[model samples]
Target: MYRVLRGRVNSVGFLPDERLIPYLELAGFVSAALIQTFDLRYNLISALVERWRPETHTFHFPCGECTITLEDVALQLGLPIDGNVVTGVSLISRPATLCYELLGHSPSEGKFTGLRFSWLKANFEHLSSTANEREVMQAARSYIMHLIGGVLMPDANDSMVHLMYLPLLSNLHNTRSYSWGSAVLAMLYRELCRTTDPSTMDIGGCLILLQLWALYRMPFLASISHQSYIFPLIHR
Candidate 1:
């Protein structure tokens, strides 16, 4: 599939194949629509990048005393071993608000990163004040937690989760600011909370990814997502 896509960059099937125009505008719209109903909005590069952004990506915190080992939180929550899915989702979904978990404080941290704070910062720093952004991050986190708990929570809507994957992926790739990352994650969680079915699928994919990469738990691979079925030896 990837090869076919690469070979046919000019196929017009993708759209706007014009030199100055970004193919993402055309491709992204189509891609977003296809997975718009799902939780994570999977696409080859965007999905992998979103799923991997936390560990591989690092950031410089200017003035926040927020630092928590994500692994510890998952342990406390008893949600399997802290792997890429949990860690990545936590960071992305909670963003700077997660810093409170590390700061030995609570109410203040919540106040600092809540929608009000996000909104205040949005005008000045242009961070994550958008209502749409908040919705998406919330949904992503909601999806992750429900998966661990073996349940699905209701959601508000699917547009943000559906449309914002690539944008979030792009942001993660282009920025080093931790605040931005947190804001994006919160929005993602909100989107996940909007629907039950998508939340199930999203969490299912995360568990499968975790089993394959983290605990070396492979048996679940056959039952979760299709990606695990790829036999490295055969390809090699």
Candidate 2:
């Protein structure tokens, strides 16, 4: 499966030219490790940001589709994903294993833990520089946070709560701070209904769309992460 992505135009380059490899590598690894460790498929997790791809030749993933959840991922992996979007991670919490696999380390061959942090930090700094970088960085961070909260801190109130709250808060606000806020909100609300009471639909879904009304003034929510640099390129 990993081989299928090789020499594929480096889709990430469209967002952050310099940081593409590191983020892509981490994404591919996380997707792969999650698939193997928890038996989830890459398409589900990949689908989250896949819809926001710019109309450029460099990016390869699909765009403008429904939001993919950790639950869908777990279901695809054949794991018992129940109770909310996060409850799926309790089945396999192995950061060390996931990090090792992503960095190409073998279990008997010791661990490559430091490489994981180094890669993330380097890419983080590299991605914080411009508009496009900010969007892509946030997306990547959101993905990592999903893995961390779903798998490692499944019930942890801090990160998981914040993760859920961000979409809610963003939807309520007037500024389109992030391009995918609505998409993320949709997924969060769905999970809210799935894991809790069916009646939650009234609150989660309503709150999300209501907040997203503020997005009318903000068009960059979908492509803002990488568009900062793209506009100049187009104008030139």
Candidate 3:
């Protein structure tokens, strides 16, 4: 959230949350420790931004018809997604194992946890086809707040009250197949742009733009966390 907000406020506007790895380049051990300890996937989001730059050559057809399937997209991005938009995958939660890693112990090599995107797909289907960027961002924002809430407690007045849990570390294997968090986010962005120009629907870029609206850690959040955050629940 902090990264996304900063990215929006910066001169380049919003771009892949400003590359967290760059700041940690000197601390390889810390980076390695973080990966082992938390299995965080934000790094992958940054990498996707780099690879899918507008000027960069991509397999995605911008000027022509979008003949690509979701499976192809998942494979191209190295995301561990499977099945189609109809059926969903399963991911195993591993918060306890992640806790162990922080205590100088290795995480259990258990199965990865997941969430379903079928409902997301259904939700996407129901969202107004003419949905604007702001609407997309609002959806992303609630999902993020709900995700954090699931890790501990549901946001008391959060919009996404249906979310019960989110995976930890190893459970967040790849975007969708791991936890379906980023996958659903990316899906929302994609669905919103379906009828629009392919060039404008740059997946990574669009996702970052949407993420800016999901800002939970802006500079002023300290002042508003207790009161302003509890806006009327948006049921998208």
lDDT of 3 by residue, 1-236 (tens): 11111111101111112122232222111121122111222332232232232332221323332222334333322223343231233333553363233212222355433222333223332335565544443333323322332221222222222222322222221213342334433443443333133333222222322222223213332243244222221100
lDDT of 3: 0.28
> On residues 17-77, what C-alpha lDDT tens digit does candidate 1 reach at each position?
1221222222212121121122221332122222232332321123222222334223322
Backbone clashes in candidate 2 total: 11
Better candidate number, 2 or 3, judged by TM-score: 2
Cα-based lDDT for every prediction? 0.25, 0.30, 0.28
* lDDT (10s digit) by residue, model 2, range 1-236: 11101110101111323444344343332332133233222222222212223232122322322333434333332222332232123222443454333322222344322222223333443444454643554544434433333332233132221223222112112112222323333444443333233232121222212122212223343344233342332222
Q: Which 10-residue span in candidate 3 carries the lowest summed lDDT?
A: 4-13
User: How many clashes (backbone N, Cα, C below 3 Å) per candidate?
Assistant: 28, 11, 4
- Score candidate 2 by lDDT: 0.30
Positional deviation of 101 in candidate 1, in angstroms? 39
lDDT score, residue 87, model 1?
22
Candidate 2 regions with alpha-carbon error over 4 angstroms = 1-17, 21-89, 103-156, 160-187, 190-210, 217-236
CA shift of 216, model 3, Å: 33
Candidate 3: clashing pairs of residues: 91-113, 91-114, 92-112, 92-113
When 1 and 3 are scored with TM-score, the better candidate is 3
Alpha-carbon RMSD of each model: 18.3, 19.3, 19.0
Q: Evaluate residue 111 in candidate 2 and report its C-alpha lDDT on the 0 to 100 scale.
A: 30
